[model samples]
Target: MKERRHFIRIVYQAPAQLSQSGAQWSATLKDISLHGILLSCPDGWQPGDDPEFQVDIVLPETDVHLTMTAELVAYDPQSLRMKIVNIDIDSISHLRRLIELNIGDDALLHRELEHLADLAEDE
Candidate 1:
């Protein structure tokens, strides 16, 4: 198998809510990266159903918040899985800090950001 992920994923079980086309579901955040998320949406999802989706990264305490809209890249029927597409960076600084906190390092995050920047330039 080939590795195809841009950012490193870290296990994070934060609570979240997903909504699309008048369909809303509470989901358990499984793992996350600066770009995307893998979550368990008990309400289930269908493949190729790219509805207008929003993910609110709800966490305990504090007033900080991070929410983004993403396309549904894939869904697993057997496990009620949901994968969020790469977030368009409207909050890159906050996202960077979140990734740094979870990964527990700044250098790695910086490298990932640089790589992402280079990729953007090439496109």
Candidate 2:
């Protein structure tokens, strides 16, 4: 089945948190869409659990900073990976633009293109 959600995957090293007073953890963003983002952090989160976090995403071309809140969505013990969900879309547009620019030629971009075409056709 085709992926219903479109995401731009990128790898970056940044500081993230699970709570206001929680410990800071290093994380790598896996993918991002208009509404949310997915990231991999150290093995410290559980499925269905929500943990607030902040992440700084560097724009690819401009090196601009985009910071936003993220919530823990899932965790894998075998890979020691945590999937984070970003909630702030407006605050991260620059980062998304950077990702789109970098990923314009990728297969994932084609998928997103197809999804957009479908949406347009539906409308």
Candidate 3:
């Protein structure tokens, strides 16, 4: 199989809530990258079910909250994974900084961001 992701993932044991309308569940973060997040929920979910995620990250210096809507990518009996298809500018900026700091690789982060910017400019 070919590697298809643009960002590196790392174990991020954060608390997040997934919700759609009246349906909701709290889950532990399994792994995260700049583009997607993998979580272990109590139950399975379906693809095409647009859901909103709110992840709370508290640090000693400051606290950050990310609220974004994502599209379901894969799901199993106990795990739910989604691609961050859409996010607000503020949240995306925060996420980018978070990943850069956690990954400890500013150079790599800059390259990726430049690539994304070039693609967007081409569009």
Query: Tens digit of lDDT per residue, candidate 2, span 1-123?
Result: 987444555554433333334555555555565445555645664444335666665544554666767554445653223233443555545655655776766576667656645755776
lDDT of 2: 0.53
Among the numbered candidates, top lDDT falls to 3
Please say which candidate is ahead in TM-score: 2 or 3: 3
Could you tally the backbone clashes for each prediction?
Answer: 0, 0, 0
Lowest summed-lDDT stretch of 10 residues in model 3? 53-62
lDDT for model 1 comes to 0.68
Give the candidate number with the greatest TM-score: 1
Stretches off by above 4 angstroms in model 1 are: 44-48, 78-91
Superior by TM-score: candidate 1 or candidate 3? 1
List TM-scores for all candidates, in order: 0.78, 0.50, 0.77
Error of 2 at 43 (Å): 5.7
Worst 10 residues of 2 by lDDT: 78-87
